[model samples]
Target chain A: MLRNTPIKRKLTVIILLISTAVLLITCAAFFAYDLFTFRQSMVAHLSTLAEMTASTSTAALAFDNPKDAQETLSALKAEQHIVAACLYDKDGKFFAAYPANSPTNNFPTAPEPAGLRFEGSYLVAFQPAMQSGGLQGTLYLKSDMGALYERIRLYSLIVLLVMLGSFIVAYLLSSLLQSQISQPLLQLAETAKAVSERQDYSVRAAKLGRDEFGLLTDAFNNMLEQIHNRDLALQEAQQKLRQHADDLEKRVAERTARLSETIAELEAFSYSISHDMRAPLRAMQGYSDYVMENYGEKIGPEGQQYLQRINRAGMRLDTLIQDILSYSRAARAQMDLHPVDLEKLLDDIIQQYPGFQPPQVEITIEKPLGSVIAHEASLTQVISNLLGNAIKFVQPGQTPRIKIRAEPRGDDLRLWFEDNGIGIASKDLNRIFAIFERVHAERTYEGTGIGLSIVRKAIERMGGQVGVESELGKGSKFWIQIKKS
Target chain B: MAVLGNILNPSKEASNRRFTHRLRACLAGFIFLLLAINAPAQISREYQLKAVFLYNFAQFTEWPPDAFADPQAPLVIGVLGRDPFGAYLDEAVRGEKINGRPLIVQRYSGIQDVQNTHILFISDSESKHLLPILASLQGRSILTVSDMEDFVPRGGMVRFLTTNNKIQLKINVNAVKAARLSISSKILRSAEIFPPAAK
Candidate 1:
């Protein structure tokens, strides 16, 4: 509020008005005093003149010599301010008058009482002509009041000049005093405004003097410095947080890129392993069969049996390689799950293989099986593996009997494939899902024991879960749970 | 006097004092005589001073109106016997007016010739007739002055005396008061005022 007011004008007005009032009062008092003194001295001087006139005219008035008295009164002509002077005989009548130019004839036709009086513009005094014995007559003097007025005129002129001088002096002094305060205040205001408007805390007000304004300026500057430092600290903290975020992002990007490279290299190794191992196995099988056929009679029955054994081992090794490849592919491939008709898919699998054709193996799917969320190829692969496992792991003198059905379970569809087969023992249930492991002896199984593991891996990759319930003499029921679309 | 002495002597006081002491005696008379004899063409400065003294005395003494023929009449100083002050007195009083009256010097061979005069100077030529001159002017406001020795003691109003070779005043206040005139105290202070001597 104070900042907005023009301090110089306010202070100057306050000081100037007060000083002018005081100066005018003082000058008026002085002028009044001087005027009073001038008037008093003028009266005193005229009184002296009256006394002198009376004394000198005593003899003339006593002797009744009007001429001498007139002459005595005429001497006052030398006194410029004495307009007229007259002498009154002892009879108290105007007798001898001075100067034909008697200012006015009203020089009191009758004698005035003895004393001095101010009459309009004149100072009239009455004095008795005194001798050693008695009163000779009265002397009347009328002096012009202009003398005192002259003094007043001079004093008035002096008063006017003095008033101007005092005003000028007061103005100059107020300017000097105001600059001491107002200049610093203005500087502080400017700096504070600059800081607030521009958010520039670096701006500082100047400390021009060791006064209150200076202290204020210092305080403002100090506050700005604190804000500037705080801002600097905040900026530093933000910079550090950003740097940390960037570092974190860079590390994550590097780790992700490295992980992708490792996955790609593993896929390439798996593919080559599957493809290369099969070729060599096929060549070995072909050579063994040729030996059995081309030199059957010459080698004898024992040699032919050993060669067949070698051929069977090669075929089993090739199947194991294919199982490994399928497991790796299921684990690494991106599978999109869609609703698949489990009934149709099972029927298609049966028709595609002669083993499931009627008398070879009994495969039954519950009619009108509902659809489920699953990857098309992976889901087919999984079901195929399960069917094949059922047939291969069956009890020795029984054809494989399989049943497929599905039921809704919460937000998911759980499908079950029940098969009449040599059931897995509860102890090997967890182990059954691992690769290259068989619950039964290899001679008893008659096949690689990798079908269930493949099924479990494929179902898991397609976002479905697989589990089994089995007994040693009865069949096993394997279930797959998938999210309902 | 100290200021005058110093002005005359920049370096020493002894010669200044001795020289002025010698000059004190008849300084006015000798100046008058030398100017009249050796420099006849020159105005006598000595009588000029005496003429001024006469007018100055008139200013201090108040006279009765009876001492003038009329208010318009001039104030007369009657030289009762010889006229010592020549044209110097007239020259000194030329165009001078005191109390609205001009001062005039009149020469008188005897007391009978003095009429309506405010002052009477008894010159040395009338020294023997001083008694009758004063007696004739008794009870009048005529200030009596003379250069005769023992004039104040002999009941004269003012006497010019030579003391320390300087012209000095001897006044008899009693005799002046007897003339019914008041002499200003200022003139009395500078004059050697005396009481009536033991008869």
Candidate 2:
């Protein structure tokens, strides 16, 4: 985050310089304090000598005997490193002084400590001798302090020089150390910048030492390694996802092609049954009709009965052919499912059966014949076929009562086509709907036994199930359950 | 003082000429005597010349009245500590004297016995005692000398140094202040003044 800044270098350098300066300043201050105290003490010493001399020699100066005063003054002058001695009375009168060769009372005088500039110069101190003879005199004495100042000043100068020299040395040494530290840090910063801006993890930080900078470089290299690994993982994951999508697309394409082939084969089988079987059935019926019509006048009643058998056989053959056609059409029809009104469908079926007038026809259709997912034409055929079978199989002297009902059963529609008719025998009920099978003699019922079989095939093609429940001489109910896909 | 007067009396031109002629003859005679006493000047010639000059300096000097506590006391030329000249200086000062005092040699390890020493020769190794020795002999008739760089600058009486690879001496005028001893101007002229070299 701080790639563009030289914050590390700045912080390192600033800390080094500040600490070095603080140490140097502290040492210098201590040395200076020592030097100032030594100077102060030296000045105090000189002033003390001056005061002592002034006090001791006040009495000797007051005596006023030139010879005794001169002798006393000479003794004072004998002090080592004394330049000249002067006896001053309490009244500030000069009685005598050593080195009488000079102009009397005209010797050079300094503030207190004399000859501080030159080494080994004299210091003059006055001592006043208080006599018991009521004669107050001053005795002057001189003491040299020039050597003391010289030694102190020399010592202080040496300390000052050493302090300055050490400070410079320390500053230079610290600066060198800071460079050693900061140079690598600066290089590391450059490497980090290059890594981020150029996205080049190959550039590694330069390792400078076995210190903290080297450790930081190791950490940086590790972080780059992790980033590189994650990048590779993401790319691999993306590639895998692409491969999965491609496999799914290919499978869907293959399944759709196989479904198209199955639909074509079903259409071809339906077409062949419709055209080929209908022609042969038509020829059979036509030949039978011609024989019965021409031979009826020439033959007697016995011959006429035989001719009638031929005609009935032909008619049965024709019903079989028609049932086959119906089955083929249901199987091959283009399925278009929509919302179907079963009430409207049943009313139309009843009107189509006007010629086969039974005593009465009672049709009850439940309200809300619900809409469903189905082909409209196929569903219409399903309702019409079941209703026609119910009308045709009515019992003698009994009006047909047909009820059409629909209700939801799970995710499908359960439709019921129930009627009261000559029901099937219990043993033959399972086999009654098979092709070419008759439950009774040919004269008893007029059907090819193909109607229920066709209905089953048609309802089954529409993705529905069909079943019947009945008892002999009682009634039968048929149910069709079609699932909503 | 008399040798300085003879050398610097420029107004006595004819006498000065005669003096120079006689000095040349004396120089020849001294050379002759030096040969008779020892060998001719060869290597270590400076050592030989310095020994002869040291003997001359002792003879020309005059000590104070109380310098010798004993009347028959030797005019001791004490060689304190190491003496680099070996037997050459001993041979040169065999019978030298100043003001009728015989030249005697004394060797001392401490400054306590330095009181009566008229001429004190300090070696380089005994530099630490030079100042104290100077102080002890204050107001006495002692001439101090050493062999070191600028010894007179460090408050010695006379310093012996090597200039141009030749042994030479330096004298400090301020060192003679308390002693009240006047050095011959001829000697002063011959030796280099130490104050200028010190500065």
Interface RMSD of each: 16.5, 23.4
Tens digits of per-residue lDDT for model 1, B1-199:
0000011111122235456445543453575576545332222343444565676667667887677778778988778887767887888667777777887888888889988788888877787777888888888889998777767878899876544323456789998888888886645544577883566
Q: After superposition, how far is residue A40 of candidate 1 from its true place, in Å?
A: 1.4
Error of 1 at B34 (Å): 70
Candidate 1 chain A: worst 10 consecutive residues by lDDT? A59-68
Q: For residues A291-399, write the lDDT of model 2, one tens digit per residue.
A: 6687767777788788678767766666666666777677676766666666666566667776324456677778766666766677766676677777767776778
Tell me the whole-model lDDT of each prediction, alpha carbons only: 0.76, 0.63
lDDT for B86 in candidate 2 is: 66
Report, to 2 decimal places, the DockQ of model 1. Answer: 0.01
Model 2 CA deviation exceeding 4 Å by range: A1-266, A296-324, A336-339, A354-363, A372-374, A386-485, B1-199
Output the lDDT of residue A113, model 2: 30
* TM of each candidate vs. truth: 0.38, 0.34
